[model samples]
Target: MGNILCDGSPIESDPRYRFQGRQWETSMMDAPCNNCKGCFLAMFCPCCFAYHLRVLALEGRMENYSCCQGYLCPTCTSKCIPGQDSCPEFCLCLEVTLCENFAISSTRFYIQDQRQIMTDPCDNRIIRFNNCVQILSFVCHILAIFFRELRHLAHLLDLFADLVYCMVQACMQAQTHHELTLHPTAVDYGQAPRTITQQPTASDKAPLMGHQAPPAYSE
Candidate 1:
């Protein structure tokens, strides 16, 4: 007789076998302590707490995460190109533009990473660069009026921003390094490639000597 369990097994087949699979690990941090020494530190120094929070909730190494984003912000050093005529102002403008792109793109990357790990769908959507700054600024001012400790919330946000800024810079540097490694040009090499100047041969020099007068007869 053909077996009837073509796809998934019937629910009534077994009760003990279903519970044996490996458990999935969570990527979220636990709630901070309330009354202990840790809580005191967290309350007094929320920036440090946020750093710890980020380090904990993440699944893999922080370097890996930053490296992934770093490749996106490749560096363009036109000024360093060999023999290429590049104006000072143009290079300066490009550098400034690259910096701006790095900041904006890096912030976006951080926000996206945060969204993936966040537990609340609504909160994830609400937490963004512009929204975070504006909302937190307003909230900080209002809360500071009531709770004295809340004044530090602004500082916490600043610290977090600073951290992201540094991370973005790191990503940019890493990507630039990677790009340079991949394409080492003549300029990047110790010196620009030497041009082969054509040496004058006997035939070429004979023409020039043809017009010259004979050696002086004064012997």
Candidate 2:
């Protein structure tokens, strides 16, 4: 099947899809400095910021924004709940409120997939950091079995690492938002309806032949 926007409009002709793979215009570390407003919003009000980014991924159509990029309800369009026509918005809000990290990650993945943007070194670094934290946490758990004091330390380390991870994720979201602003998707939603006019064909313009022509009139 061809590429479609969140609003279910076909976007096979979108310019962004013309290039199969490309790197982000700005790195994650530089995003906060480049777009201070986005960074501030992301850091201070991540839930709202995540929702806004999701809408941006949908080409600025708030109505088209979905919770988890509609992966939770692949078959349901517009409304995920039975007999409820306007449940998507509520669902999205709830998702952002309760599952902020998942919501933000889904939006980021959606944007990247639509634009064919590849993960950069910064993304790999974040992944490595998370991996290292997990490994350390496991080691700490094993060490805590012998040393009771290490148990408290492990809890403290986990809490600190979680805070740092959240901060890093917020920055990543800001970076994605800034990059999206620089290179917006070309979805058809929220635009004026198009009107198509059919041009006259060659046969329609051809002169009438033989008997089909009108008889010559006398002066």
Top model number, TM-score: 2
lDDT of model 2, residue 93: 76
Runs with alpha carbons beyond 4 Å of true place in candidate 2 = 1-21, 60-66, 70-85, 138-148, 187-219
* Models, CA RMSD each: 29.8, 23.6
- Deviation in Å, model 1, residue 167 alpha carbon: 1.9
Q: Candidate 1 lDDT, tens digit per residue, 87-200?
A: 323322332244443323332233223222112222122223323344445556566666767657755764555454333233322322222233332133333322323322
**Model 2: how far residue 50 lies from native, Å:** 0.5
- What TM-score would each prediction reach against the true structure? 0.25, 0.62
Q: What C-alpha root-mean-square deviation, in Å, does candidate 1 show against the real structure?
A: 29.8
How many clashing pairs per prediction, in order?
Answer: 0, 0
Which candidate wins on lDDT? Answer: 2
Encode model 2's per-residue lDDT on 147-191: one tens digit a residue: 777777777666666665566666678778877787676342233
Q: Which residue pairs of candidate 2 clash?
A: none
